[model samples]
Target: MDVQPGPEREDSHVDSDVSASTPLRVALLGAGVVGGAVARHLTERADDMAARVGAPLALVGIAVRRPGRDRSDLGVDPSLVTTDAEQLVTRADLVVEVIGGIEPARSLILRAMEHGASVVTANKALLAEDGPRLYAAAAEHRVDLYYEAAVAGAIPLLRPLRESLAGDEVRKVLGIVNGTTNYVLDKMDTSGAGFEDAVEQAQALGYAEADPTADVEGFDAAAKAAILASLAFHTRVSGSDVHREGITDVTPADVAAAREMDCVVKLLSICERTDAGVSVRVHPAMIPRSHPLAGVRDAFNAVFVEADAAGQLMFYGRGAGGEPTASAVLGDLVAVARHRVGGGLGPGESSYADLPILPMGDAQTRYYVSLDVADRSGVLAKVAAAFAEHNVSIETVRQRMVPDERDGDRHDVGEATGNSNARANLVIVTHAAPDAALSATVESLRTLDVVRGVNSVMRVEGS
Candidate 1:
């Protein structure tokens, strides 16, 4: 392995010449949307970034899975583009990986670090799945591993949690991290659109993908939650460890119920420190309309972090985009370049604490439950009894009588013992309780004779 000497920073006003120091050669692992932007930025802004890093940051090569794809529009020399990713990482001082996923990307990154090159990656899925291994490799090789783009795009989130708040103890991190689901939910709340309609609108507006399963089914947010929890709690939490629930089940009725209480439903990624350990979860949650997170409409993302010393901090911006993600990647690239010139590595993983991952059932949170029940007398009492049986306490309850539409029957609550098909929509909000207790309570309610069906059950997050 070859060693590069450090570069000293000159005064900002000076037109500092860096001809004496060796150029930091950077290799890009993909040329997709984000990778193309990174390549363009590095090539176009080479002079500016070189001055900032007190050295020339050179784009030596671009590794593409497909060979002979017309990337001349990205302003890279066609000779620099090649299909051989494994060979490209060998002759570089630093590698920037935007090629997402688990396989070849992971193998290439590991090989890069093994060959004495620093790495900057925007691969969130790889990080959430196997961060410890990559971090360990970087540590063993004494090279900097920076990934500022993995979570929250250009929002500058992971750095604050990993570096800025290194001194303070972060107690909780709650974020609207997924833009696709957020856009869908916001559309449903504002336009009274059904789930499928909102999703279609999102797709038409470019907020969602053709196959939005990963975003809608909470997998994307769950992966982000896993990353946030690992950083905030100083633990190793994988995507599988996160308790996930998607927004596909959020109905227009649920949206209307949220409006009735001056709230909005959002797919939230929540990470918190608990008595047992740390808890991480992703799901559609009800936040008060006045809350900062609730007002985060459209596809924008925001994260609220609570720390012991810093008190409260919120980072907000475009959570996902080609240019935005490229910005983050370039930021990390410069940082790694500077580290190479300065002969020092940036902060690596800090999972020395290695706290346990608390079970989702043991996590405590409030819930909003809507149930359809027979409008006969003693129905509310029976529901209350079921909650008590599970030791869950109710905070507020609202009921409305609706005519049963089955077979066009008009049932009245005032018919006494007559043949009435009236049914009650019981909306119950509960205080904080264990999730297991709440889930068990819902199960018991389903078995009750008076209960018709569980209309919707959603967690209530953010004050």
Candidate 2:
């Protein structure tokens, strides 16, 4: 950082240049990929960023777990790197937190605001878990807390919902938010790979972590879902409030079944407003190919927002990566820095609506159920009765007969039970109903004597 003379030196006079363009000393937490990109931008594009922020931006320090580690290629002065994140947070006009998770990152950010410095963070877990605390700190301290990168990387999603669409009513927010699961599901859809093989491919390609539980199991997307729902609905929604289902249960049969119905399987983050209240959930769902979110293949992310005045809006782009996430961090840095220099705060948390998060069972949705049934008369009637037992109305039903091993030919499901020994694949699509009712229908089907097995059960969305 540029060594600015302290007022303790008792200078006779200061120039208007120094007064007008005071350097916004920035402390970066986490010298990982995202932090490295942020550092490079501050170093390589200092003049450009300063011009945009109406003040000079200076890196006070880069905090890391190991200051002695080889971050030589990260493009920052060695002297400016330190292990003391606590002290680093105290000594800057703005703090950029890329270190994810709760605990220390949360504590450090709270400390930064307490010390009277604004914060810009991409820590989604911390935000989704306890965002109200951070917002309260910023509001009480009169500081800015901007986190555009927390949701959709560089898509500029949160600002639009938080600012541009602030006047409008957001009815729903559906997205393919987790890149790792999206890549896995997309691979399964296109290459016909099984869930395990697709996940292996995603790990080899760096789309997933060594321990891919967070991404594949939907916890990562759930955190992002909570954040999106909170912003879109003007309510306080936390990670626990969001219903989470993983992609681990997705099978090759599920992928093929989706395609047979002109649909694709995606790990979707869905938030909606119902008559009861708002609902937030993340799960692997079957959506028609015509839907915009279905076309978002591979590791890309897209959020489809439906609002009263804005109608339907789709934000699409690279969802993850160091540089893309840092782009969002830098954007927030400039905005927060401008607020610091110009003497004002940007928007804080707005939970004025304070809508209660509805239970997952109450959310209205459709179901695509695949059943292995005995190839006998009255099988269809018995299955239909199972759905009716739970008040779930079936929209469509089709049967795929299993081929006889004796001859590579399909056996007719309508054939007499004495002549046919094959089981039939009975596919049923249900009309939109309460999720609990649809779930109960699946359970009831499992109990019927005509049903041999429940092959797959997936939610149908985007129609």
Candidate 3:
């Protein structure tokens, strides 16, 4: 709703009077929650959109598998609905794609571009996977491809990185981009609930889906991370390029451990321009409670961007749902339509930098490791030696007697710590190191005679 008209290309062949009178045809794919809202928006605000775009924007057709289903509630005529998406795309001057996924959506968009129609889509998964192909098609056909709704929904995130901050040098992008995971993690942090309980609460509140594998398992967030990384770093970052770790492994013990260190666990999508090239990852990491991202709770999304000129900028708002996501789709639709009437195209993919995506092994981040070790003199020395062997530096060490803690399940390992029969929970916080070396250090600790068990190991971030 706060979207401003982006600058059109300098070159224009169409006269202002001629372009203003020309009506642009719009075709929609998928009439789900987002699509239904988009239909209502176009029908209800036809006069407003036409005035904004300097030309009349007409809804020519709506593509749907089930045409008989009543869309009267959305003010869309039953006749506008058609099952043939291929035919619908070819006829329209502009295509607004809210239908998600890879197959039909991708094919239809390419077909639309081939027909010389500009496109606006909200499909992050498709963009992360085969964006370069789509970009190439749009460039070859000389049509615009705008996907402002792809990354952070209606938050106006991708546009700022791609356009607003185009002149600035972006160094890093850290975000809580997934609303479902954010709600689940926020519930766990505040209510002290286990991962399952928090996720159940999220589902009950309509924040998460019945099958939350995509959200909880971090696949959705990873896709968004790839898109963000590609835009911010000017690299061809795909979903496979990101190092993903789901929130499923995040336990109550890990949450409590974060409390002891004045931190909170959050599933963070991080992209950084490193000396090695670029690093992008999505994982549940511990951030200090005072951090800006830690305060983003419930089904709310926030992205913290760092640039050389801008310093640091934070964009916070709703990242999903029908209306919010539709607002973004509508924004792109308006921009592309204006471009059609005015002549010239919006910004295409900017991967000229073509930075290489660094592997997870080279990524550097702090670690919060909880180990069940013998509560004896030389135990710390042996553990310190293990870290030193891998060249990982230690920041802090906290030793907790199992008897002092309220949680009883932690000290179940008995008679394992030699003749002492006492196990101490050694919570070791490490300085930044390569992820591969940190994981190797944890593995080496497991083999140590002093350690009874490796309870948990989570990455620490945000200082």
Candidate 4:
């Protein structure tokens, strides 16, 4: 397979060896797709890499869960493979960790820094959960720790935040970072495929995993949002800090309703700095079809950034997969290598701005609420009164009559009381309001006798 480098790869320059100096050796943790790709890239471009780094760069070791498995395709010698991940970190000048999760990846990264080795990783979950702690360790040891691949894969988001746009004050970062969920939602809209069928298609095409809860339920996007919020605001935000809602609740009716409003449904991870504090949320939302994010379809990603100086800027591309992810890893490796050879390091400790994370109830956004209500004389009036009670202004209201059953089953008032098919679908789009007010309005509507059921409630974005 051909190896493709990232945007920063062209700037890589290997240095000449000093009289007493040795080549910079790198150990890779995890032999998965990303790990293997990093190894392959390093070996394939060893000559160019050496020249770029101002010293020879060698792949010294690899750590894998199953050490006995054949990894010859990675282009690394079998002797370099090891099952003991902790031991591998000590022998190299730098460690690139792709193994995910919180336990060993965390421990190994800390240990590598303690041993005076620079570290690069693509583990978003680990970083999102405990970034401050890891950065503290790197600061204490004076070692470089970079994670550009954590958010939008192949998109140079992290470096842009840490370096390129450091002079500017970033106000908001709204991104579609999870490609699997995007793919599923796109299929649902374009092909009219249900959730299950779209997910199955994604799995078959390697766009989704067998256990896709992390993707579908917004866990993955939440993690990315936490990372983005931290970098953009120069604060510490964890996975627990983000309020996440998934795409599981989206239905065909919801899709059609969005289309009627000239909107498209997308899983959005939004991070913003407010007077109250930093707000982070991940949820399926409706974006106007004219918005740039609306054009992002299938398994692709895009991050829309709003800053003081730059105004609105967007970074778009493939966000996942081996080659795309590997491209990011290699880009970081080259930069880290150059910094090491020049005896210089990038930004040190993150000067946390001490921003508080606002609760989800305080988040402000518009909502699309679908209600099944009894088609009676005062049902709409009662519902409108309930919304007014909570101070929520309705932007648009769409009502569709439910068709009567073709069969000879009697449709009584009792049967139509709470049945969605027995009542008219009342779709209401609300103006931007406090989440608490929206919740109060929804609660009030649920208690009304004329309200049959709430089919769906989704946030509207890019309005």
Judged by lDDT, which candidate is best?
2
315-339 per-residue lDDT for model 2 (tens digits) = 9998999999999999999998877
Worst 10 residues of 2 by lDDT: 5-14
Candidate 1 local lDDT, 1-463, one digit each (tens)? 1112223223211121224256777888999999999888877777788789888776778899887678876786787888889977877778999989899989999998877888999888898899899999999988888888988889999988999999989999999999999999998988888899889998998889899999999988998889999989899999999999998888898889889988999999999997689989998989999888998888899999999999999999998988999999999988887777777778989987788888889999999999888877788789999999999999999876675655545444333544345677889999999999999999999999889899989899887
lDDT, candidate 3, 1-463, per-residue tens: 1112222323322232226866777889999999999988888888899899988777878898888787777786677789999977877778999889999999999998888789999999999899999999999988999998887878999999999999998999999999999988888878888889988988898888999999999999999999999989888999999999899988888888888889999999999997779999999999999999989989999999999999999999999999999999999999988888877788998999998888999999889999988766677789999999999999998777676243343343332334466667888999999999999999999999989899999999997
Scored by lDDT, model 4 comes in at 0.85
Candidate 1 residues lying further than 4 Å off, grouped into runs, are: 1-20, 404-417
Worst 10 residues of 3 by lDDT: 1-10
- Residue 450 displacement (Å), model 2: 0.4
lDDT, residue 366, model 3: 89
Q: Give the Cα-based TM-score of candidate 3 against the true structure.
A: 0.93
RMSD of each: 5.1, 3.1, 4.9, 5.4
The per-model lDDT (C-alpha) reads: 0.86, 0.88, 0.87, 0.85
Best of the two (2, 3) by TM-score: 2
lDDT of 2 at 160: 94
Model 1 sits at a Cα RMSD from the real structure of 5.1
